[model samples]
Target: MHKQSVFSFISQLIWVYILLFSAVSFSQKLTSGFKHTNALINETSPYLLQHAHNLVNWQPWSEAAFEQAKSQNKLVIVSIGYSSCHWCHVMEEETFSQEDVAQVMNENFINIKVDREERPDVDQVYMTAVQLIQGRVGWPLNVIVLPNGKPLYGGTYQTKTDWIKLLNSLSKTYKEQPEKTTEFANRIAAGIQEKNEFGTEKGSVFFSKELLNTNITTLKENWDLTYGGLKGQQKFMLPANINFLLDYVILSNDAQAKKYIKLSLNNMALRGVYDHVEGGFFRYSVDTKWQLPHFEKMLYDNAQLLSVYANAYKVFKNPLYKERIEETYQFLNTIFKSKKR
Candidate 1:
């Protein structure tokens, strides 16, 4: 036990050292063939590092960034996305890298790039507002807000032309008709506040097996037998859904449930989406049978999956489950240790 604790201590120290070195490496601006530098140069997030040399005046989400917008009476352009997001990278290359689009964004909007993993609270608030307006929310989530910090307009990835058009239109609408824009902001803010009013919501008086059984029944209804996930896998949230079912399996001890769990685990681990070359999972399997994949290695995905597999190993002492947990841990400990503040 003491040896295990010592090994853990050394492992953590090594991780810390790696993160510190990485932060220092990312601090230097990459100057090869870049159009210009921006405020993102001062940021620590790996996602922000990817945008440090963009022509857009990209600032990390901060009190100072918002204050600068307020003082200049400029609208805020909050772009929230994570490091491993494919669409976010696409938008960066297509729109933010373009000279014309960057000029408009810099001139009219205080553009802020947020790592959603780093600031989920900020993401939650603005994403809620985006959902309120657009009826959905997604990565590369671009939200335009008033100088006073109320959301005005929000959308996911737009074409370069469309983004330029949006920047111009919102700037115009905001300047020329302050009253209309203010009304819109007020309405959106109110809606966001209302949706967020879950503070007073009652919790269950007590836990019950009946409630668990009901949820398990819902799971059974949703289960895709052709594929292993709860639903047909255009995308897979295996860690969240499968991990929960694992607890249900242990609690119920249903023979069928155990078989299903094993089936799901084996398919996910053996599938192309599981990253045979790498030690982590792709974001999801694009195909229903987990053949094709969306290859983005998210920290949360690997982190949650590590827990799920680790728990599975603990219970069943399965060699496959143990191997998965070890591999996933290695992947996360190596790649996701960014120096984001």
Candidate 2:
């Protein structure tokens, strides 16, 4: 062979060696008895990076995933979770890591994992569905949907065996009971559509002065003065509602409403739900006393509550409320600034 032919042969040999070495390296890196064809390597998200080598042929939440599911007539299994959640990690190891479970999921459904912390809007919509379906919701929420993104069924985490059984059952149901599936999906879709369309009409209707006063009176009647927040075991620091109360107090010269607003803000700021160390509020309290929190501190919640505290300081001339507002701002600047992208 001439010099040029020898060089060409050498280049071809090098390419073949590179390909074979890469295949061996990949095989060695994968967990025993689990192999997948995912192309999500080097992704930055901690949650997505964790699943980069999962046994399931996972696709990112994309138009392609939905389109493929539609073309294949497959149900879309949307698994929503966050990185820090312990149960989310457990479910991944137990079910998503199993080769057989992954095979069933890949074959029968379009599995899509969503990082709830990354895309809260998606989480909120499906979480609402899960709540509607089961009358409660939690992390690692799972929803099964039709090709058009209409949720057909929803629940929380399942063990490997249970998930496999559920997948098998759902696959059979989808294949054999098409009309029944469509009927269930349509009912949910119509209900959700109507709820979304009508849910905000209350504010529109109660825009009048007398209606507003009446609503304020009704809300104050249920206020938990002893606990210093709204009346509930699951206490949410509803800043909007608080602001409405403040407005009512100012307009109607209601001393009780103003007193309730101050008490609620002070109690929430002093409670464990406020993240005294970190200086941002948790999602909400699980108990009536505002002691135990759900522990997911969201950006929007912190921003809104920060403003509320700042306004409270302006109204009451309280240094503690002003300090809380500054601390919340600092927390946002430190944590959220890093995660903005």
Candidate 3:
């Protein structure tokens, strides 16, 4: 539960994740022998380039691709993720590269592979829709959209069987029940537009002390008191949640909330979610205990987490929080230095 001690304890387990990361890169390289290639071959993005050899005819997000979809009267498959995404790599290997899977996708849909880092605009639109439809979202985000680009269905990381079934079913539905598909797409479009719209209502919203307390109380109800982080099978280290709670604790001197935040921070830092070897956090844990990491080190997540840890160091002055901030700083600097070359 301390500085170097946590690293020493978890060092052995860290190598297993390191090996998995290495193997994904290695397998991606081996695809050179596969005869199929797509327009993604010409893309500069490392994430898009990774899918260049897939049998699926992947286009970088463009007017031309959408134009083709309009011309062909086909739905669009907008699959978005970045290079460091583990599920994206898994979906590429297990679903995209397959001959049969690619056949269906190529025949039925205009498949657009988006590097989320490069196209946060596109990601935001469909990501909001996915959250609206599924009430949850994560990468390797796969959405089926109308040719004009309204989403019909959105989900993440489908197995090859499920991917095929989904494409076939959606394709069939679009062809047979055109009115129904359009109506559904219209609803999703409305929800996305409404969610993205800034509330322009004139009057300033009043926040009473009682109302603020009620809001905090409602939030606390969702907290996983035992292991920390939100109550769910999966645990994401959402810096915003911690950032808000940290500020509230400082202002209100809320002992109970402070204790819970400390517990959350401690568990997050010491658990498998934080890379013991690499000095950055993974995207999330597959389990609530923060022991089963999803194995993708997202820069945005790590950068925001750095702010959370540093601010916590200001308040708690915990040496462990300071250590995490230092480690994450070093990790980010190393990444930047490499990119500079």
Q: Pick the candidate with the highest TM-score.
A: 3
The order by descending lDDT is: 3, 1, 2
Best by lDDT: 3
Q: Write the per-residue lDDT of candidate 3 for residues 1-341, one digit (tens) a residue.
A: 89688888689679888999898877667555779878887778999999999999999999999999999999999999989888889999988989999999999999999999999999999999999999989889999999999999999999999999989999999999999999999999999878777575678977798998999999999999999999988998889989999999989999989999999999999999998897989888999899999877877899999999999999999999999998988998896347746
Span of 10 residues, lowest total lDDT, candidate 1 = 26-35
Q: What is the TM-score of each candidate against the true structure?
A: 0.71, 0.73, 0.86
Local accuracy of candidate 2 as per-residue lDDT tens digits, 217-329 = 78878899887787877888988877766666667878888888888888899987898887899988989888898778877788889878877776788898988988888
**Model 3: how far is 85 from its true place, Å?**
1.0
Q: Score each candidate by Cα lDDT.
A: 0.83, 0.83, 0.91
- Rank by TM-score, descending? 3, 2, 1
Reference-based lDDT, residue 171, model 3: 99
- In candidate 3, stretches whose alpha carbon ends up further than 4 angstroms from where it belongs are 1-32, 339-341
Cα lDDT tens digits, model 1, 203-299, are 8666687887887888788776665776753858567777777787777787767777777777888888788775888888888887788888777
Give the 10-residue window scoring lowest on summed lDDT in candidate 2.
31-40
lDDT of 3 at 82: 89
Q: Which ten residues in a row have the lowest lDDT in candidate 3?
A: 332-341
